[model samples]
Target: MHVLTKVKQPFNFFTESVIDLDAVNFWLQKINPLWSSNKALGKIVQKDIAADDMVSVMIQINRNFKFGQAGQHHPVFVAVNGIRYERTYSLTRLNAQHVLLTVKKVNAGIVSTWFSEQAEVGQLVEFGLPYGEMTVPKTASPLVLLAAGSGITPMLSLIKEMSKTQQLKEQPVKLMYWVKNKSDAAFLARFENIASHYANFSFHVFYTQALPADARVNASHAALVTDLANSIVYACGPSGFTAAAEEHFAAAQNVQTEAFSMSALVNDDIGFVNVTLLQTNKVVSIPKGVPILAALEQQNIKPKHGCRMGICNKCACNKAEGATKNLVNGAQNTERGNLLKLCVSSAQTDLVIDL
Candidate 1:
C-alpha cells in the first residue's frame, strides 16, 4: 500500500497536468473507494434506529477526515437519483477512525430519508470540514445542557467528551432534555450509567406528551439547578426551544445555543431584489431582508445547505457582484468576489452569485 501511494502521488500530479484531478480520482476509486486525493470519505460500519425516526450510523472514516471538537457539525454529502445533496449533522467521535452520526427523518427530507431507510453498511459517503462554536468551555463553572428532539445529538457528543475527561466528576453538570414522547429520547441508558457513576452529573428527560404534561424550558426549569447566575448553559433544538432556553437562562453567566431548524424570519422589509445565478444563468426575484437560501428555495431553486443557522458554510457561494446584508448581524457586504453564507445573508440589491 505504501509503495502504491508513493507511486500514485507523482503519477496523479503528472496526470493532472493534462486531465482533471476528479477524473483521476474517479479511476482511482475503482481500486479503493477511500482513495480520494482531496475529498474526505467514510464507509458506514454500523446502523441503528436511535429514536422514533432517528437513525444512528457509525462511519469509518479515511485519513482525510479531520477530527473536530466534540460539539461541531460536519457537512455530509450523498447522492440520490444521480443528484448530489449535502446536509450537516452533529458528529460524535467514537475513535480516531470512527464517528457517529445521528439523523432524524424529516417529512420530505431527501438525504435524511436515504440515511434512515436506504443507506447500507459499507456504503461510502463524503464529508466536509466541521464547523460550530458550541464546544465545551474550559471554565469550571457549573454546566447545564438543554436539548429538545434532535438537538440531543450535539449535547450527547459534548457529554461524552466531558465524561471521558472526568469533567462530569469535577463540577456540577445537569442535562435537561425535552421530547414529545418518552420513546423520542435517545441514549437514556448511557445517561443513567453516567449519573450512577458520577454524583456530580444528573439528567432528566421531559416528555411533553405525558398525562400530567411537562412544561417546556421556562423559569421553573431554571430551578433544576442552583447557582443559575453562575452556570454556563448550552442549548440546542428547534428554533422555539432554543429561544426559550435563552430566555430561561437570561440570568445565567453564559448561554450558548444552536438551532437545528430555523424559524421563519420576521423582517419588516417589503421589496424584491433580482438575484442572478451565474452558474445556471438564471435570475430569481427574492424578497429583500429574507435569507438568500430561503428565498431561492421558495422559487424551487434549491442549493446545497447544512445547519441553516449560518454556522456551517455548506450554502456559502461566491458573490461575483452586488451587495448583501447579514441577516444575523445586519452587516453589509458590497465587495465583489466575497464569499457569503447564503443561509444567513439577504440580498440588499441586485446580485450575482455562484450557485
Candidate 2:
C-alpha cells in the first residue's frame, strides 16, 4: 500500500531513504557529462583588457564551431584544482577559428577566479553549444541598444555582426552605454572606432560615478526615446537599471531587456515542504530557508542548472503532480501542471516531479 502520511515541517528525506548513495552519485556523474560537449576543447590564444576588471579572452577552437545568433551565449567547462565548473559568457566576435569572450570577474566566483588568475595559454577547455533566446531581429528598422557595465558584451556582438554583414546600411543604429567611469568601460575604444567608421552607427556614453569636467550626464530616458523614436530598444544591465529602462519604454512593445540578476525570482516568504522523484521513488524534504534545488542536491540529485536564479531556464522540469510557488511573481501553480524551474521554485505541497 502507498504511504499517505502527512509530513510535518523540516525533515531530511535523504536520511529516510534506503537507496545506495554511491550508486546514485555515480549515475549523476555519468548523466552530468552528457549535458555538455566534451569534444570542443579549445586553447586560449590571447587575452586583452579593455578596461579595469573587464577582459576579453580569445580561444582558438580546433574545429569550426557552429555559429549562433548575434546575442547568444555558450557555457564553458573548466577544471581547476581537480574540480570542474561551468560558466557562461557571451561571444563578442565570431570567426572561423576563434571565439572571443568578454568577462568581468566577480569576487570569489569559482570560474571567474580561474579565468582571472590560473588560466594560461594552450590549456584545453570544453565549451557547450551556443544557446540563448536574445537574438537580433533581421529587420531594417531603427535599433536602440542600451547597456550598462559588462552587459555590453552581447550588444557589442550584435553591433559587430550588423556592421560586418552590412545590415545597418538602411537602418540607423544608436547605442547608449552606461558605465561607472571611463576606466570601467569595456570595449570603449572599439565602440568609438566603430562609431567613427559607420555613418549609420551613433553612440552616447553615460558616466555615472565620475566624469571629466567637460562630460555631461546622459541619464534622461526621455532624451533617449526622443532621439530614437519608434525604434526597437534592447537593454541589458543590473536588475534595477533594466527595470528603470523598461519602465521608460512601458508603452513601447518593441522594448526587450536582459538582466544580470532576477531579483523578481527570489522569494523568501514561501514555507517549504517535500518533493518526491516519482520514477526513482526518491524524496527530498526542503526547509523554509533553502531552495528546492538545494535540498535535492543534498540527496545527490543534481538537476541541470545554469543560472540558478531562473534566468537561463536550464533547470526546467515537468511537474508531474504537486504545487509550486513561483519566487518571482508570488504566483502559485497548482492546476494545469506545466514545466517549472526547479532552481527558483519551492515546494508548496507534497510534490511528485519527473526529475
Clashes of each: 0, 1
Range of the 10 consecutive residues with the lowest summed lDDT in candidate 2: 29-38
lDDT on C-alpha atoms for all candidate structures: 0.88, 0.72
The whole-model C-alpha lDDT of candidate 2 against the native structure comes to 0.72
Taking all chains together, each candidate's TM-score versus the true structure is 0.81, 0.77
Give the per-residue lDDT of model 2 (tens digit) for 1-355: 9989977433225423536655543453365422222255567888777678777788877542556688887777889899888777778656877888777877777777677777777676777778776677776768888888878999999998888888867678888888877788787777888888888888877887774532222345536556455678888876666767776765553877776644444546555567778778887777643457767888788888876646677888888887777654445888646988887676777888888
Top candidate by lDDT: 1
Off by over 4 Å in 2: 1-38, 211-219, 227-229, 263-271, 288-291, 307-312, 320-335, 346-351
Best by TM-score: 1
Error of 1 at 98 (Å): 1.1
State in Å the error of residue 326, model 2.
5.1
lDDT, residue 18, candidate 2 = 33
